[model samples]
Target: MDEKRRVAAVWLPHWPVERLYRADRRTRGKVQAPKAPLALAAPGQGGVRVTACNRTAAAAGVAPGQLVPDAMTLCPGLELRAADFAADRAALKRLALWCGRYTPWTAVDPAGIGEEPDGLMLDISGCDHLFGGEAALVADLQKRLHGFGLTVRVAVASTPGAAWALARYGTAPAFILLPGDEAAALEKLPVAALRLDDATVDGLMRLGLKRAGDLYGKPRAPITARFGRHVAQRLDEALGFAREPISPLRPPAPFRARGIFAEGLTRTEDIEEAVRLLAGELCRLLAHERRGARRLELTLFRADGEVTRLFAGTAAPSHDALHLARLFREKLAQAGDDFDAGFGIEAAMLAALATDTLAPAQDRFDAEGADAEALAQIIDRLGARLGHERIVRLEPRASHIPERAVVSVSAVRGATPAMRGWRAQVEEQMAAALAGSLARPIRLLARPEPVEAVAEVPEGPPRIFRWRRVTHRVTRAEGPERIAPEWWRRGERRTRDYYRVEDAEGRRFWLYRDGLYLRDTEGPRWYLHGVFE
Candidate 1:
């Protein structure tokens, strides 16, 4: 039999209130404030409604979704604060980062409609022993979080669903259910503890199924047919019959190196040295795995609890430690004053965010391939200094139209293989595609300019034309090659008759008559489309 994995859930019952309090304290620089009832509200149809409330507000008969007027009536001195969802989400992300010390795999539960998230899920699995045991870990987490002025409930179980249910509704600050004990431990909990919606819970209650134990032996078909598959799925997940996966906010890197300092270092040289050391260690890891990083991230954890991150990308996959360090140096130098070492950096972590397969290249005695590699490195450096968006190359796209045939893309990512092949084929077939004519223009106008011309007939080539106030008399005329619009596209379907004409001064011009003469329009319009060498 496979060993059961352990999971832990950390529930913060008053996250919104705590976040607001923290912000207020930080802005005011006051540790102690008035202990008045407070509530966060959002504009609703009737009036502003309470979204979250502190314990004091709850004790004064205020609840979430309650109208602000009613809450105010219940507590005359109630303090109502507008909710800051962005700040709350940012705080949750930072908390998830801080939790990285406990477990590498941690995910923040997304906030539900009309409710802010108050919990995080962590896959502890085989990591419980590091803090002595599961019970010890729970105690340590609770104690440490309590120092942050948060009221937290910690629970551990065999499944994420069970751990989440027990952590939020287990009637204790800390709870643990051994493997195979989930059913018994969750028997008396309310049906809502299964993560059901309010309507489902109310419907279940109306049917006299008030607790989880009441549905334990019932027929699955009847319940699922009435309440839907989610009910059965959640139940199964809690009982370990169905798998529930947790997606971490940041995926753990395969190659990582970290440095911890006893005393924070503030000097740029010290930080660069630390980065070099981490890059060396990371490159060693990549070497062992026979891979190279395409993108690297350097994270600095400040002593003042701020986190700074820097990113560098390579044109080609690279595993050389010195080259990677040099790229970071260039990035940092370009960052200049933006990369602030606020109150010094206590720790530095280097991670290979994205990687690719890299095989050892055979050394060459000549410098034939060396120049290409050097050029790629130079492009990489330029991309790191200026943003990648600023360093772009024109790539051929799959289009027959002159203007739509080419596009701009990041130089670091290179061009698509299909586009390159298409361009090559087009170059080889130029003569045949142009109908045996070698009069293709050297420069094509972005948008054709209208020209006044007098053709020999309504359907013939131009004989005299006035373009940009200059009259050109055609001495040689070649074609009336007809081109049609793409039928698949919507809009006006105009056919163009192009002509390669040479003026009396030996200057060649490509002009086209838009629309068939008297077929699609009353009179055809002449346009100067291109200039031939």
Candidate 2:
């Protein structure tokens, strides 16, 4: 028979407390917990209440979800800290990245609001042998996590659900269930081990289904009908009858490299050197894969449990190490005082966040080709230093309205494929149309400015107009092109009678008369809409 797939679940019981304590340690430069019971509070229905508690608080009978007043009354010396959900999530994501040393498939399981425990799931099917055995891998994981001053439970089983149950609900700190042994392992555990909600678990317990074994022989339909489909689904997943795939925090990068220092490096020069090395390594990997990175991120892991991330993007996909390193350097220079190396950085990781197929370019003897490449590189550098939002290119949009005809998008990322193709098709059509028509203005105003004008009667072109506090007599006028607003979009729209007029000084302008004079009781209004070279 084929061997069953193995999954490992690593549970961090008091993640919030640990995260708080670590932050405190970093600030105070000491490894000490508060003398009094500590709790993290969140706003609840019954005023502010405790959402998480440290061991000291839990030992003093200060349970989660308890009112702050009651907890303080129970332990008068209780300390309360506001919950930092964003910080906790960031820490968990960094931990997931650190776990990449164990398996490529690692996902963070964050606790929802009001939930106690949070954990990580890793698919370690063929990785156990590398660390001696399954048990040895778990032991190593536990030891490494303990070194980081975290309390954790490690469990391995044939399925992710089974491993999760054993890790969080099992009696031991570490446990492993062999293939086909999940049923026996989970039989005596509480129904909560199936990852059911409190309401469902309560209902099951009231029905005399406290342990998983109580419903083992029962019909699936009745259980599902009573407690809902989640109960049956969780049970089946735990019993290896269903598949549960983990969505990783970040998709695995196609090209990546890491540099680890024995002792943390604090100097900026040293950090840059490490980044340069990583860039070279990543470039080699990309060359081997025949792909190039368009977006890259450099992550610095500090000794003080802080992670700093820097981003760089390219106008085009590139596999050149020096160019990539220069991009990172530009980003670092732009960061100025924002990027910190608290306590010093122990590891640096370079990841290609977005990649695309890359092939060798033709000979660059052509000056235009070289100029184009140079321009792209310049744009990439400027974008890296000045921020992508500040470096923009005008892209043609699908609109007849002058204000909506073009959009500004980041030059580095360029336009979307659909937008680019649509613009190309529109340009092709416009080229054919413009071949027989008069030239359009070089610059169009976002909003046309109202103008006072004198024109011939019977819908003729303007003879003179005053715009922007200046009067100009029309020396030449050649248009009465009528452009009507989309009647299908709205009712009672105005039709513009446009005229291309040149002044005595040879300055040309696009003037439009709004509405029809005979159709509307009020006469038409004139506006200056654009300028021509």
Candidate 3:
């Protein structure tokens, strides 16, 4: 049952007026949260209209949806601030991210079309115990937001709909509904508490259903015919009969370790120490699950609501705390001056984003294994400093063409199955080289350069060739090694005869004739393709 699911809704009543004047920019010396009577105004068919008002304006008989002239007459000293709907929405999202300090499962309440959002939702299912209990968690959350001069109301319950209704309509500022008590707790509230639109609420009120309890056990068919299924769906969701889950701003990482400090940490050294501790804790968590991490992320929450994140990846899955910590250290070092600890870092968390199953095994003591481990460490460090794409190794491809026989792949991915016989291939090439047989040149041209050649025979090696406006005579040459075109490819049906030739200056060139010898046809062309090392 979802009775175990605990969600909290936080409503910021004055957000529309406060967002404009809040001291939230990266730089200081800006406007502070409004304390005087203020109203947010927007352009309408009339001269102007008030969309929302602060507590002082509300107390002075100034309310929303009123013409500016009428509102000014009600509170002559009312201050008017242009409503910035876009900025308010963005600020609300930032506030939701700030709530990550309480729980990673935080999101801006999804507002319907034409509705302005001024609230946040948190799914703190298994997170309440960290702050003592459900009550204490709500209390702490409210206290911290109030510290930032925000006016908030909070409610905790088993469902998001229940919490949302209670936070906005319940009598108490901070309320908690015990599991399985949603119906009883919400019955006495107005029908609007079910989050119905004004037209629907008015229609229900006209039907003598002014309170949510009035809809209980009533015939659903008539209501469905009149109001469709939204009302019933919302009612079922709030009463815990149906599910309505909030989508968090960021999904919580499956494996994570968090650290909170009484006082903010300012020094880099202290943050590094905190990372070390978190790494050790994360490694233990992975070991318990018999998994290893391949990618990791570290998030630092600053006191000023600014968040900084650092990411690192490994060439191989690892549960070694020291090696993982070293990877983050390299990332931090690379960040250097870009890393800003504004005000101070109040909390930090390390999460394993990508993981793989790992089986325990004895450490290898052989030189080859040690060398491999060392190489992986180097790759990880370099990847952290530069980029993983920049750290690449050549992987063998299943192709006979010299140019198409290899591809570059990121080192972090290691090698592929096609590379299993790479060692044997290299050994065979070395044996040919030592036996005075010609092997492929180390440096191959992007495309063969056309050359003028004079061969001893029609299909034999070139006696001399002119390439790049330079002429060279062949001192010694090897016979033709015929290479045929791939049948699967659509190109000229011609075969190439490759030859290894050396000049008097000890410079070697690989030359090839384009076509086979024909009795009566256009003569074949010769090209210089490569230079030997």
Candidate 4:
């Protein structure tokens, strides 16, 4: 059996086409803010000149290499503005996804934007039978997308090259083909059908070989000699004189559930009922396909033509509709409060955005890992209520400096690391040291506050010292554990002598003195910082 394909091409008018005007520029809202490309160059006598025109912009009477002033003069009352590349790209991607109903295999054309991604290629293969044969399938796609006001041209052929050529060059009932007749069908088509460069096409036209048929009947030697190898090469491939590969855009991730309400569901209960039915439908499809979902997406259509999306992820793959419904309950509940069912949802789609493979869980000696799942659910709930950042897990950073350690991550998804082996022992020791010594204030100042002090000793306990306008008498003190500042870091480096001192009130304090007494006029100063409760 010969391989037959039904390929459909959608013309994104915004896509660069030569001299063809695009009106979609008006759709550029605040997000993109694209300027209009056409403007009335003053009510002119004949026509207006183009100011800044691209190939597609020029095709609309804004020709390339044409002076903007001349273009405005040629076509008066032309709307001039900047092209919104972002909006155009987004619309193209949406069109690709919309094409899914026709075939699982659809690919975008090599040409984009200025080149105008003319159409998409679909290797319908065995799938066309589901839509009641090739012609009906094309008709169905045309009817649906045309409702959206899209201009589409489709062609079915034995090879991608033949289909592509006919779509661009042929007319409607836009498809053309005959079994084992590739050469004859493409014979009369222009050289442009082979997707050759503009320079090549112009050169071929000048040589009086305007059509593929003209070149097909002529001597091979002279055509190659005049236009070089690339021209003849593309012609040969399009005519199936050489093998041409078809790279269809891989079908997007499959979505199994589609919901259509009986009377357009308006109430929350009605929507939930619809959602449950859709989830069940998806679950059945997933089971039949022998796959499980990791992430599920629910798309809700509001009566007013608004689409709302909800997303959920599982720790493991699942195909249970009830479980999926539970995950969506919170979101669906909220949607009822916020959404205005202007027309009632016309359509809804339930899809597994991600899936994973796994074997069935066996009965365990102890209860399975529900704790982790429950915690995840709670965290997710808290994150939804209070911004995600408000609920976080503190992860210890591998640094000795207290402030350098401990980072925050969303509590819902992050896993706490186990402090095992030497690390665990060190943490335990640090905990013990803090707990046994004294009750320390939770907030520790970044650094000690320096203060001028007078001690009675020649290296003995201080009799009196004033710190921040408070006088203190140190009755006893322990020897200092001197610490030197890091000299490599260029700044005011210092040496510290720390002491555990008891004041006259018998209250213990941690104090440090910066720099040793030298011949400099300044004396050693003490600083009281962190409090030991």
Runs in model 1 with CA error above 4 Å? 1-4, 28-30, 43-48, 65-74, 85-90, 97-105, 110-114, 125-148, 206-208, 250-254, 257-267, 302-306, 341-348, 369-372, 392-409, 414-533
Native-to-model Cα distance after best TM-score fit, residue 364 in candidate 2, in Å: 6.9
Candidate 2, residue 424: how far the Cα is off, in Å: 9.4
TM-score of every candidate relative to the true structure: 0.69, 0.70, 0.90, 0.60
- Residue range 1-533, candidate 2, lDDT tens digits: 11358888999877888787776676766676565688999899779998788888899999978999999999898888998877887788788777765566788864422464378888887768767899988997888677566889989998888888888889999998888888899999999888888888889999999998887879988888887788888888889888888887668775788776878888877888888899999999999888988999988877655668889898878888888898888887777787788778877789999998887778866697788667778888998888877988777765555566677787887547645576575677689557754456868888899999998775888888999899999999877777776557586477888888999999999988898977877778999989997
Order the candidates by lDDT, highest first: 3, 1, 2, 4
Model 1 quality (TM-score): 0.69
Better of 3 and 4 by TM-score: 3
Tell me the tens digit of each residue's lDDT in model 4 across 1-533: 24454345443332432112323322431132123344312222344332234333445566634555666676554555544445555555545544544554667765422353545677677666766787877786666544444456677777767777777777664574664676788888887888887888888899888888887757778878877887777777666666666565542457567755557777777777777888898888888777887777776755333456677665446687876776777676555557666556666777787876645665566655666456656665554444456777656665433344455655644454532234674676589567653223345457778765666664444556677788778787765656664456566445666666777888767677766776324666787756666
Look at candidate 2 and tell me the lDDT of residue 30: 67
In the range 176-221, model 1's lDDT, one tens digit per residue, is: 8889998898899998888888899899999999998888988889
Worst lDDT 10-window in candidate 1:
25-34
Q: Is candidate 1 or candidate 3 better by TM-score?
A: 3
Per lDDT, the best of the predicted structures is 3
Return whichever of 3 and 4 wins on lDDT.
3
